[model samples]
Target: MEESEILRRGLDAFAELGYAATTMRELARRLEVSHNFINDRYGSKEKFWRAVVDFALLDVQSELDHRMAVGRDDGERLRNVIVQLYRLSAKASAMNRLMSDESTRDSSRLDYLHQRFIKPFWDSIEPTISSLIAAGRIPDAPTHIWYFAVTGPALALAQDPIADRLNPAASPMAEQDRNGMADALSSLVLQGLLPLSRGDATDRNG
Candidate 1:
């Protein structure tokens, strides 16, 4: 009934069922609405899926934009962006799940995701990437490698079942734990990607 609730449930259903197997009727049932609600309101199932994506990703895009605007430098900006992304993924990983499934196949949905989210996201971070490359903090790598590097780390957040079994206390779903987890991930990722300074390397070597 409520638009946000509908979109959230739809996003989760699509992520769980996959695009083809998730019928509009099933979505309506999940949402506890009439089976034709999407057809009547959104025009079609494809359009409904698009709406769900648009709704679910808006906050993430906004967070990235806000984070990109404020960092002391490119490296700092990259770290801030990654940390914010981890926070968001911990908040809700449905979009990531949907993306993981869609990425394995070539479909219109995948194209839509690329055109709408993936390309824009990459473009948004191009300045940071360029600055890092120039500073030799990161390599001048291919787009796909950068893509996987940035996004792949967050995939584990989507696996609550495994996490609950393996380390219940460290579950990312817990809000109080998210900031520490994000910071830890940012440190781990940046340390591996970034070239250590002369003094830092010397300290480690010593």
Candidate 2:
């Protein structure tokens, strides 16, 4: 099989089993190859894990870069990025689960993900954020807080199984529901980031 196909299957396995639980032998078995073949192709389990993450994030990074480049203004760029992020979170539940698993602890794998995927993605959006702040389109808040505000809801919904049972209308698992949730989330984040109105500013000052 092609290397890309191998990496794709590896991503699915890693996403489902996480880094610690996923064995190279099992992965090879799933791929219909010998364990030695996998090791020979990727060198080690760590390398294979890294490859999985890289493969999963490759399209996301590309899409983000394209949207950010094509956006006409700070507001538009930010909106586009937020919408894209929400869409990805809703669609890639398994990948999100894997990321969540990694985030609960400190490890070389986590660090590698940060350096290879997360940091670069954040760096691509930082310029648009800076522009938005300078233009007073978004509040002058710490980047980390902004990140949480933008991503927190989608991640929560993706990880929470009971969410749909509790509120089927708001669940993003269905295509229609996912689009609606994406719209709502984008609006929520955008409205929160927008500059305070004159009355609100005056009241704050008073």
Candidate 1 pairs with clashing backbones: none
Tens-digit per-residue lDDT, 74-97, candidate 2: 766777787788778777766777
lDDT of each: 0.81, 0.76
By TM-score, how accurate is candidate 1? Answer: 0.86
Where in model 2 is the C-alpha error above 4 Å? 168-180, 195-206
- Which of the numbered candidates is closest to the native, going by highest TM-score? 1
Candidate 2 lDDT score at position 149: 73
The residue-by-residue lDDT of candidate 1 on 76-159, one tens digit each, is: 678778878877876667887898889899999999999988888889988888888887778889878987888787766676
Best by lDDT: 1
Q: How high is the lDDT of residue 153 in model 1?
A: 77
Tell me the lDDT of candidate 2: 0.76
